[model samples]
Target: MKMAGIETLSWEPLFVMRLDVAYDRAHPVGGENRRGIFPVVGGTFEGPKMRGRVLDGGADWVSWRGDGTMLIDVRTALETDDGALISMQYTGLSTPTSPEAAARFARREPSPYEDLYLHTTPRFETAHAKYEWLNRVIAVSNGMRTDDGPMYHVFAIT
Candidate 1:
């Protein structure tokens, strides 16, 4: 029995992996919060649809909100096994359950995703004809913070 005007959404697994990022010490970027840029050193990702390693030089620009939220702008690139370059960016908030959990995250401890809400709508860009589908799809990623960085389970809406 399907409801009228309502369609059930299904998730297609796009990729999953941990992202490695080098945390740059927080600096004063002014105005009411401390700003920091974490250089995305390198990492790996793999799944049924894609498998790739993170390139060097991309970065995550983060702003510390006075609240428990960490506002983030993440820009990174992935080179697939077949040599297609995919550009990805996601902006989201990471909110900790308590000040202690927030401190753990700041200290680069093993703060699990259960201790915070880390969600993002990831947009992809690609030019290869075979992989052009990525540019037309809507995807979201739920991420967990580890000792090294964040791991995301990427899903495409189908």
Candidate 2:
């Protein structure tokens, strides 16, 4: 068997999104796991090439896995300052660095980003000609939980 050699990946800064979200108690889905739906009430994103406000109707459906990792599924809408609308979605994982960190997160304590391994791959869609480039790029993000909700530093793979 042979494997092809690939070039190293590079990233280009896209935006920083900070969300304001609301969470309700999760319900058990099965053995040692639970599910929760969180509403993304509001947020804003800014970067060198674009700026936008996150629409209020978006949501994040989270799965609390038995192994203590949080599986994230998020869908959201964004309105550029110029009125163009974009749809964004991502699936990611948030795993605690240790059992104690997981416990702190479960208690809604202030667990720093250093205490968790959080990463996401985001996809973008839009019909607006001005930003059509987004439709073809691959993107990833590094994320952290905040008191207000979560913050992400999004980048496009090059």
Candidate 3:
């Protein structure tokens, strides 16, 4: 018997987004996790297709699990250079490469991107005709934590 082959997926560079985040203390929610809220105060993004500033008033609701993994749900908006507003949301998983790294992160210390696994799936919505294409693309991002916030290299699935 012969097996069918699978096609490899490809990606195209979309943008690089650096979010200036404000952290809030995490408090125990209950049985197995702690919850925290992080505000997206401001930032900037640039790419081949677009460039803009990240609007204020967005936030990330984070859950720190007992198993040392962080689950993040973020909702933010972007204002293009030309003034088009786009809403963006993403869900992501963040895991430290080691127990020490996890401790450092908990203490709000910065870590190299290689010291953690941080990945996100982002969905974009826009009413601007110039950016309508974003509404239909499947996007993914790899991110790293910084002292000021987090920066992500976003890509579009092809």
Q: Cα RMSDs of all predictions?
A: 2.2, 2.8, 2.5
Off by over 4 Å in 1: 1-3, 24-30
Candidate 1 lDDT over residue span 25-87, tens digit each: 434465666777778888988999789898987878878787758887889999998999999
| Candidate 2 per-residue C-alpha lDDT over 6-62 given as tens digits, one digit per residue, 9 for 90 to 100 | 567799999999987866633345444577778887799999999989999888888
For candidate 3, write residues 34-122 as lDDT tens digits. Answer: 77777898899999999999998998888877788899899999999999999999999999999888888878787898878999999
Better of 1 and 2 by lDDT: 2
User: What is the lDDT of every predicted structure here?
Assistant: 0.83, 0.87, 0.89
| Number of clashes found in candidate 3 | 0
Best model per lDDT: 3
lDDT-based ranking, best first?
3, 2, 1
Clashing pairs for model 3 are: none
Specify the highest-TM-score model's number.
Answer: 3
